[model samples]
Target chain A: MTHGISMAGYMFVNPGEEILVPSLFWGNYNLSFINAYDAKIKPYNLFKGEGLDVAAMGAELMSEGDKKILLLNFPNNPTGYSPDVREMKEIISAVEQAAKAGKKIVVICDDAYFGLVFEEGIEAQSPFAWLANLHENVLAVKVDGPTKEDYVWGFRVGFMTYGIKGGTEALYTALENKTAGAIRGSISNTSNLSQSLLLEAFDSPTYQEEKKEKFNILKSRYEAVKQAMKNPDYAEFFKAKPYNSGYFMCIELKDGLDADVVRRLLIEKYSIGTISLNNLLRIAFSAVAVKDILALFDGIYSACKELTV
Target chain B: MTHGISMAGYMFVNPGEEILVPSLFWGNYNLSFINAYDAKIKPYNLFKGEGLDVAAMGAELMSEGDKKILLLNFPNNPTGYSPDVREMKEIISAVEQAAKAGKKIVVICDDAYFGLVFEEGIEAQSPFAWLANLHENVLAVKVDGPTKEDYVWGFRVGFMTYGIKGGTEALYTALENKTAGAIRGSISNTSNLSQSLLLEAFDSPTYQEEKKEKFNILKSRYEAVKQAMKNPDYAEFFKAKPYNSGYFMCIELKDGLDADVVRRLLIEKYSIGTISLNNLLRIAFSAVAVKDILALFDGIYSACKELTV
Candidate 1:
């Protein structure tokens, strides 16, 4: 997925050009966009009132350059949130408004967490589908893989698909050749053994059923996290961010309580690990046992209390 | 191997700077140094007569530039030639002389075909061992992998090693961090499954013996190719270049014969495939069976006759 995103930067943006990502995003975006391509990272607010800030996205799109790169990842890392159907439509509408205003937009949908949604009423499909054929001026590039989807973190297999309204075979062929050139110049090629395994796994008779079983296991853990966050005592320490569909959820620490202080306390006192990001504590519920979810929260609650004193 | 080379380009060479390569080097050097890093490729004559041109290399090193990147590939591609120990020392002496002349050098030893030396009196070990720690002003970088070494091409596993005189752990660590940063910005990490498999293969009791068996098979093919090239009939068509190691050998077309025309004729009439580069045809004798080696060369001879008529 990172390879794909970095290629987008190579293919589209020149040095010092801006790529707009969310304010809270995977930190590796800095390495890919800035370090790899020498492009600038322009961040926009990700959320407004527990939903995607479509207004902020639209504003960034129309604010400056003739060519804009809007990178969207969902359910995003650190703060797992996937937009519901209405929000998806609104996001697309905002992009459409920008495209109609003569902005040449490249919408990169990083669907690393594809099909991991655990909640109903959320649009589980990738937004690439809707934005693909929306406008001639807009190009939708999807970077997805079985790394997260199939639990093969080390396989390092990922893909990039390009979409544009009225895109011809010649255009896609040219784009593919350029992408191949970029890859050929770097790693030579990806792991063929890993790719063959994925192909065989996809063709298995029980593949879909097995995947569903695993998804249900993670969904149960997500439910356990949701159930534990309802505790009244924990509310004073931190407020849970809007989350539904991925492995992680963030909690915004209240009263300026140091998240690193709480994180260290949890690690030292309770042997629990959580990533502290400024005022946000990202808890990867996927790694914890479903039965231990409540105890994990209790540990965090105690750590926050200790920091308060 | 490419990743390491690209990283060396990224870390050491700046844009518009020059990277010295052999005139008959691998074509992908263009992609890695020129396309990826925007560095210039300055080619030096690889051969004088049948052996390596150490004088040409020395001349390039003492050229106008203060900092020079010298990339050397042993058991080199296209013309599979590795230097004997005496010639290697001469090459090193040339570099050391240039370094003493205040030329800061980064010598990249691309040892992709390491351990494949077929002839006696040849230096089988990588030149990196000698180049490393030779001088404080020279940094030796070695890029090699199991792709060719262990015959696991699809696994895509390679490594990069750095060495310098009086280098401390802190300096190595800093270089490692920068390399890791470059990888993180791109593919994130190599395939863990492939790496684990390579580890197991390395640990297996039959590993060395099995590898010896495979090496003997390829060596037999190389011997068969050498024996078949002794046929006087082939001299009318092409003269084989000096090759004693690696999977490939090149034939320089004789009497102004078009290599592509002969290649097409061989493919059309005899169904034999070979890569034609200008007046040279590269044949991978490693892929041909020992029993069929003579026939393959005969096919080429016949095609050349047809082309002449």
Candidate 2:
């Protein structure tokens, strides 16, 4: 996934160019875009009342220079929020508005957690599917693979696919060659053994069924977490950020509670693991079995209470 | 191997810095250093009397700025030349001379074709071993792995090792962390499955013996090529460059014989494959069996004649 992003960074942005990233984002984005490309990051508000801030994204897009690289990751890392159907439409509309205003845009759809959405209302398809052909000026570059979808974490196999409204075969071929050139200039190529294994796995008779089974396991965990978060006792500690998909969801800690302190307490005292990003406590429910979901939240609540005392 | 070089390029050289390369060199060096890091290539004469021009190398290092990046490839690509013990000493002396003159040098030992030496006189150990602890001013970085040694091309597994004079564990750890940071900023990590498999292969009882068997096969092919080159009839067409190891060897076409023309003729009339780099025709003896080496050389000779006609 990072290889694809690195290539995209090389392909699109020049040094010192601005890339619009969410204020709350995957930590590696800093390394991929800012560190590698020397591009400046312009952070925009990610959420408006527990949903994607589509209007803020559009406003940020317009406020920036005419040439913009807008990176969207969903189901997003750290937050684990995928846009619902209505939110997806709003996102497309926002990007479309920018394109209509004659802004040249490269929308990077980091669909690392593609097909992992648990809820029915959520948009199943990536923003790549919608914005790829929505506007002539917007180029949708989707970076995704089975690394997460197939639960093959360390395979290091991902793909960079380009799409644009009215995109010709020649255009895509050129983009592909350039991407290949970028790759050639760096690591040469990805592991062929990993690629062949993924190919073989795709051809297996139980591939779809197996993926469905794994998704169901994650979905049950998501359901359990959702149920557990409804406990009124936990509300005084942190408010669970609106989440319905992917591996994790964040708890926006109540004012005056340091997430890191709570996280350390949870680790040392309660033996629970969680990532603390400022006040947002990210819990990767995917790692924990469904049976452990309630205990996990209860542990966090206890940690918070202990910290307060 | 390319990944390690890419990391080295990032670590050592700043944009527009000059990297000293051999006049005859691997093509990918341009992509790795120049394209990726925006560094400049300063090519020094590679050969004097069919042996490495150690004097020219030393002179170039002395002539350059105080900081220099000296890249060396042994059992080198296309030329298949490895410095013998005497030549290796001269090379070391040259580097030591530069280091003594207050030059800060980063010697990149690209030992991609390590352990493939078919001759007795050649220096079996890499220059990395010699120059690494030679001087405090010199830093030796060795990029190598089972990719070539074990012939696992598609596995995409390689290692980057660092050595320096009076090096401490802390310094090495710092360098490693920086390299790891660079990797994290790009591909994230290598394929774990490929790594696990290579680990398993290394533990096998016949690992050393199997490697020896493969070496013997290549050595036999190398011997055949050497024998075939002794044919007096081929002397008029081209001069065989001094070569003893690696997959390939280059033949410098005699004046008026275009390498591309001879290559085409070989492909069309004789049904043989060879790479043309200006006047040098590279043949991969590693791919050709011992039984076919004579025919391969004869076919090249025949193709040269046809081109001349």
Model 2: CAPRI class: high
Candidate achieving the largest DockQ? 2
Displacement of residue A69 (Cα, Å) in model 1 is 1.0
Q: Which candidate is the best by lDDT?
A: 2
Model 1 has an lDDT value of 0.89
lDDT of each: 0.89, 0.90
Question: Per-residue lDDT for B183 in model 1?
Answer: 85
For B74-143, candidate 2 gives per-residue lDDT tens digits of 9898799999999999999999999999999999999999999988899999999998899999999999
With candidate 2 superimposed using the best TM-score fit, by how many Å does residue B107's alpha carbon deviate from the native?
A: 1.0
Tens-digit per-residue lDDT, A86-183, candidate 2: 99899899899999999999999999999999888899999999987898999999999778989999999989888898999999999988888789
Model 1 residue B58 lDDT score: 91
**Which lDDT value does model 1 have at A62?**
94
Please give the lDDT score at residue A281 for candidate 1: 92
TM-score of each: 0.98, 0.98
Error of 1 at A29 (Å): 1.0
Candidate 1 wrongly placed segments (more than 4 Å)? none
